[model samples]
Target: MAGPSVLLPLRSSPFRRYLLGQLVSVPCSWAQVVALAWVVVELAPAAMGWVVALQFLPSLLLGPWFGAIADRYDRRWLLMAAEAGLGLTALAYAAVSLTGGLTLPVVCLLSALWGVINALDTPARRALVPMLVPPAQAPGAAALSGTVMLIGMTAGSGLGALMVTQVGVTATFTLNAASFLADVALLATIRVGPSPRLARAPRQIRDGFRYLWHTPRLRTPLLALSVVATFAFTFQVSVPIFMRASFDGGASLIGTAFTVSMAGSLVGTLVAAARGLPGRHTVARANLVMATAMIVTAAAPTVLVALISLTVAGVAWSFLLMSVIALLQTAEPAMMGRVMSLFALVLLGGTALGGPIASALAAAAGVRAPFALGALAAAVAVAIAWPGAVRPADRSSRHVTTADAG
Candidate 1:
C-alpha cells in the first residue's frame, strides 16, 4: 500500500497471518509441481497425461461435495486439517522417491491424493478470506491472494528448476513437504468465530444449471470458456514435453519456461489492470489473442521464439480468464456463489478433462501438438464468443485473479 489507509486488510491480524502462511506455502507447492512433471517423464513419459488427470481428477469429481463440507464445518480448522494432509502426502511422495520406490503407479496414487487434499482445501481457503476480514476489506484480501501466488510462482519456478538440476527432484519434494508445516502452524494461530451449521440442498446444483441455461448472457460466455479450458489449462503437461522434444531440455528448462511465462502473465495482468474495467468484446478479444499467441508458441522455430510466444500466451490467458469471472459476477447477487462455482468447475476443474487428452496428443502427435490443440480450442472459443454478448464486466470483478479462480 502507498499509505496506511490503503492497507485496511492488513490491519486484520488473522488475514495478515494467513497471507504470510500463503507466501511460504504457495511457492513450495509450485516447486512440487515443477519437480513432479520431471519424475513422471523419467518414469513413464507416455503416462504423464495420466498423472495430470489423476492430479486434477478430484477437483472435477469432488469440488461441489467438498465445497458443501466447507460450508458445514469450521473453515479454518478444515483448512488446517487439509494442509496437514497435504504435508503428509508430500512427505510420502518424497519418501518414495528417496527410497527409489517411486513407480508410475505410486506417483499416480500420490498425485490423486494431492488432488483430493486440494479439493478439500479450496472451498475452505476461499471462504476463510472473508472470515479473516470484514466485508469492506474482503476484496483487498481476494486481490492480495492472487498477488501472493504470482510472487510465489516467480520465486518458486526458477528456484525449483535450479534445485531439479543441482540437487534433484527429491529435495524439491522434501522442501515442499516442509513448507506445508509452516502453513499448518500459522493457521493454528489464527482464530475465527465458529461457523454455523449450514445445510445445502441437493437441488441447488440442478438449480444453478437451470439458471445458467436460462440466462443467455452467462450461458454463452461460459460455453466459450468451457471450450478454451479443455485445452489451454494443460500447459504443464504439454510444455515440458515440448521442451524435451523440441530442445532436448529437462526439468530445469521446464522451470525456466514457467518462470518466463509467469513473468509475462504478470505483465499482462498489469496491462489489463491499467486499462481499468474490461471493455466491450473483452472476452472475445482475449480469446482471439490467446489463440493466436498459442499457435505461434506451438510453431516457434527455436527456444527463444517459443519462450517469447509462451509469455504472450500467458498475457492473453490472464485477460481471458479474469474477464470471464467478472462476467459471472454480473449475475444476480443471490446466485453469485453458485454461478462462481460453475465457473470454477469449467475453468479449474476441467484440467481433469483436458490433461489426459493433451498428454496423449503430445505422446502421439508431437510435443507441439498440445499447444496447437489449445490454439484450436481457443479459436473455437473466439467463434462462440464473437457473435455473443458485449461481455459487460462488473466493476468489482476487476480485482479477480487467476489463482483465486483456481
Candidate 2:
C-alpha cells in the first residue's frame, strides 16, 4: 500500500485555497470565543456559564435546519455569508462593550446568533473538501483542514488573551471582526465546482434524515462519535472555569493550554497526512489511542500535567476525527453534503447536550470528575466498536491487521 506522501499530488489547488479560507476564519472564531468568554467574566461574573451556553445554543436548536440549507444552497455563498455574519456579530459585541452598555442578555443573543452562523457554515465548509480533493488524498485534506483549524485556534486564543491584557476587550473583538473580512476575501478568491443540485421533492428534509437513519454504517459511526463528543466537548467548554478554579490562572493560562493542545493537533494531523490510515482497522486503532489519552487527561492532578495530557488527547482527537471523516466521505461522495449535514447534526447534538451536563457536573463534583466520566464514556464507546472490527473471512495476518486497526 502507498503512503500519504505518495498520494499528496492528488488534491487540487482549490483544496488548498479552501483550506486557506478556513485557516483564516476558524482561528478568527476561536479568538472571538476567548474574547467573549473573558468579557462575560468581566461584565457578568456570575452568569458566565449561561453566556458560554448561549454560544452553543444555536447549534442545538437549528442544526438540522442548517444541514438542510447546506444541501439546498450553493455552499460557497453559504460559507461566505456565515463568515460575514460571524464577523459582524463580533463587531456588535465590541460596539456594546466599547459603549459601556454591555449586558448579559445582549451577549447571549449575539452568541446565539453566532451559533446560527456556525450552524450554516460548518456543514458547507466540510462538505466542500471532498469535492475539491481527490479521493486518494481525502484523508490528507481532512488532516490539513484539522491542522489549519488548530493552528488558527492557537493563534487566535493566544492573541486574544494578549490583546485583552495589553490593549482591551474592545480591541480583541474588533480584530476578530476584521478576521471575517479577511476570510471573505480569501473565500471569494477560491473557485469551486458548482454545488450539487437538489430536487424540489415534497419532503426533502424528511428524506435527508431518513437517508441518514437507514444507513447502518453511518448510523453506527455517528452514534459512537456522539458518545465520544459528549465528554470530549467539555475540554473546550469548561476549561476556562478549570483554569480559574483549579490553578487560579487567568486568560493567559487558558490561551497557553489551548496553544499546547493545538500543537498536539498539528502533530497528529501531520502524522495522519504523512502516513495515512488505509482501512477501518486503522481507524479503530486510532480510537483506542484516543480513549487512552482521554483517560490519562482526566486523571492528571495538575494544570501543567493536564495540559500535557490534553496534548496527547489532541493527537487522538485529530486522528479519530479524520478517520471518521475519511470513512464517511469514501462511503458517500455523491451525497457528501447530506452525509456531512448528518455529521454536523451529531456534533452539534453532542456539544449542545453535553455542554450543560459537563458544566453542571463540573460545578457540583469538581472539574476532574466530569472529565473522568467522559473518559469512561469514550472507553465504552470504543468497546462497542469491537464487534465490527474485522470480518470472519480475514482470519489470516491481514485479518489480524484489520482487526487491530478497527
Candidate 3:
C-alpha cells in the first residue's frame, strides 16, 4: 500500500496551525537578526564577531537543563512562555534604540537574553513535532519546518534591510516584537496529545549526554553536525563583511545575497521533504558539496559569482540539516527532547566558538580567508564522520498506517 504524501503532516490541523505561526514569527526573528547585526557593525565593527558569539553562548551552556525541563513539563506551554519572553526582549531593544540609548554592550546583553530564551524554546519546539504528526511523517514535518525558516529568513533579510534603510532600526525591532506576540496567539490555538513525561531524577540533564555517548547512531551524526556548524555556519558573519570589503556594497546587497542563499535553501528543503529523508551517505556527500561551494565562494572574483556560490552552499546546507534532524527525531522517540537539545547544544556551541575565530581570521588575513578555512574544516569533518555516517540508519519505526495518522 502507498504511504501518505510528503505533505501529509500539514494535513494535521495542529501541525498546520503551528507552521502558520512560524511563517509569521520566523521572518520577524530573521529581520531582527539582520537589524541587530547591522547595528553592531555600525557601533563596533571590530566587535561583530563577539556579538555573534554572545547570542549562542547561552545555548551551549544551558541547553541540557532546558531540555530536561522540556522533558518533564508540557512543551506547548514552555514554547508559549518562551515566545512571550522573546517578544518582551525585542520590545526592550526597540525601546532602547528609540530612546537613542542603544549601545554595543546593550546589544550584546539583549542578544544573550535572546539566546537564553532560545535555549529553552528550541528543544520543546523540535520535540513537539513528533507529537503533532505520526512517526512516519516526522521527517517530512522536519523538512517543512526547515523550509518555513528559510523562506522567512529570505524575506526577513530583504525586508530588514529595507526597514533599516528607510524606516529605522527601531521599526525593525518593533516588527520583530509584534511577530512574536502573533506567534504566541497562534500557539494558543494548537491542541496536541500529552507528551510522555519522564520522572524526576537526580541528574536528569546528564541523561541526554549519557544517551549520546552510548548511542553511536545519534552520536556520530551530531559530532559531524557540530563541525559543520562551527565552520560552515559562519556565513552570517562572513557574508556581510565580504559584501562591504570585497564588493563595496551596502546593506541592500547584503540582504540580496542572503535572500538568494535562502531561496536555494527553500528549494533544497522542498526537494528533500518530497523525496523523503536521505541516508547518512547522502548527508556526507552534501557536506562535501557545501565544502566545495564555500571554496568557490571564496575564490569568486565578482559579487554575482559569490551569490551563485552562496546559493549552492545554501542548498547543501539545507539538505545536511534536514537529514540530521530527521535522523535524530527518528532515533529515539522517548528521549526526543533531550536528544534534540544535544543537537542544538552542539550546533550553537560550534557557533559560539567558531564565530569569533572566523571573525579574527577575517580581521587578520582577509574577509575571504574564513571561507577557505571553513572549506578545509568541513572536508576534515567529512573524513572523520563519513564511515559512521554512511551506514544505513535504523528506520524500524518509520512506517505508519493511515489509521495512525495524526
Each candidate's number of clashing pairs is: 0, 4, 0
Cα-lDDT of candidate 3: 0.83
Model 1 TM-score on a 0 to 1 scale: 0.87
Which residue pairs clash within candidate 1? none
Candidate 2's residue-wise lDDT over 1-406, tens digit each?
1354634633577777776777777776777777777776656444555665566666666766676677677888888888899889989988998998777788888877877787777788787776676555665677677767878877777777787778887887887888789888888887877777565556556665666565545555666677777766466666676776778878788777777777777777667666654355555566677777767766777887889887887787666676566556554443566667767767765776677777778778886666677777777667655556622122122111112222
Please give the range of 10 consecutive residues that has the lowest summed lDDT in model 2.
394-403
Model 1, span 86-123: residue lDDT tens: 99999998899899998888999998998888877776
Candidate 2's displacement at residue 29, Å, is 2.2
What is the lDDT, from 0 to 100, of the residue 319 in candidate 2?
Answer: 66
As a whole number from 0 to 100, the lDDT of residue 40 in candidate 2 is 69
Please write out the lDDT profile of model 3 over residues 1-406, one tens digit for every residue. 0135777888989999999999999888888888887888778766877888888888899998888888888999999999999999999999999999999889989989988998888899999888898877788789888888888988888888888889988999999999999999999999999976877788667766777666666667778888889987787788888888899878788778888888888887877787676765767787898899999999999999999999998898888787778777765665788888888898887888888988899999999999998898779768867887645355775333222321
- Superposed on all Cα atoms, the candidates' RMSDs to the truth, in angstroms, are 4.7, 5.1, 3.9
